[model samples]
Target: MIQLVIVTVLLLVLFFGIGFILNMLMKTTWFPIYGYFAVVIVFVVYWGNAGSLTDNLTEYSYADYIPAIGGLIGAILSGSAIKALRTRGFKMF
Candidate 1:
């Protein structure tokens, strides 16, 4: 649906911007990726129930996955961008 697309894009941009900023501030290329995974793990731990791992993992639909994929791509791109900038002699500070 249109809403799903919009939400996915929004999440992608949101994560990208946040990750980019974090990279600049932290002066690290891959920290955002690690930070993203840590945040996801924390979120899942907070929202998941006492059920089995398979049951909990299977509960999410494409609607839940698409945005996460978008966000992950965004995070990855952010790190790449920062690395590229640094390699090109563009200081982040």
Candidate 2:
């Protein structure tokens, strides 16, 4: 309930901050989105708890997914923000 909401918001802020810094340093748009996916894949593989893809997908509860979705949204937003800033002549971004 409340914990889930807090966790989701925390993940969102965490991802956004990380992605924002990465974009600033790398000067690449959309890299954070790809990085996020790569990180998820690596974590899944490294944990070795993965079954078939469908099984893996079905096993997680909403509690597991909601924060992840939030984080993904954050990462995407960071990229968009960076792109918009750059477009608007924010050279540092």
Candidate 3:
């Protein structure tokens, strides 16, 4: 359990670190884009390691894709909502 927690934290740090790099490369200050990139990176990492990580559980499963789909939906919704609010001249408070 402790190992799982440590690995999880390390993965999160990696995701955010990559996100920060992407933000710098794109020259965008918005954090939502970075958040989305973090999710993408996590998903990619999971997919890449699925065979080894989930070998004992199963070879293939739809559950593995849930995180990727959820991340994509969340990013899209957040981006659209922010765009809509900005266009309406409303500040998020």
Candidate 4:
């Protein structure tokens, strides 16, 4: 509902900010996309194995992971868009 929309927007904005920071740090447009994907995969695997390591048996369904994955996608897209704009000679102030 409205809450989901709000959260989605917030996640998008947050991830976009992260993407901007990554762009500044990495200085390579394509690297962040692959890096984000790798990071997400590592996180998912870590979370999936958390229960075994902690002996608490925590569980996460797809719903729980979607937002994080979506955020990563948003970040990658944001980085790519910025790269495209820069390549096209767009100026940012």
Question: Which 10-residue window in model 2 sums to the lowest lDDT?
Answer: 44-53
Question: Highest TM-score among the candidates is held by which one?
Answer: 1
Model 3 CA deviation exceeding 4 Å by range: 1-30, 39-60
lDDT of 1 by residue, 1-93 (tens): 999999889988898899999999988888878988898877764468847666667878899889988999999989999899899999978
On TM-score, the stronger of 1 and 4 is 1
For all predicted structures, in order, the TM-scores are 0.91, 0.90, 0.42, 0.61
Q: Judge candidate 3 at residue 9 and give its lDDT.
A: 52
Give the per-residue lDDT of model 4 (tens digit) for 1-93. Answer: 566666677777788877876776666566666767787556655566554633322365555556666677678777888788888997554
lDDT of 1: 0.86
Return the clash pairs for model 1, or none. Answer: none
Per lDDT, the best of the predicted structures is 2
Q: By TM-score, is 3 or 4 better?
A: 4
All models: lDDT? 0.86, 0.87, 0.52, 0.67
Better of 1 and 3 by TM-score: 1
Model 1 misplaced stretches (Cα beyond 4 Å): none
Work out candidate 1's RMSD over C-alphas: 1.3
How many backbone clashes can be found in candidate 1?
0
Residue 35 C-alpha lDDT in model 1 = 84
**Residue 12, candidate 2: how far off, in angstroms?**
0.6
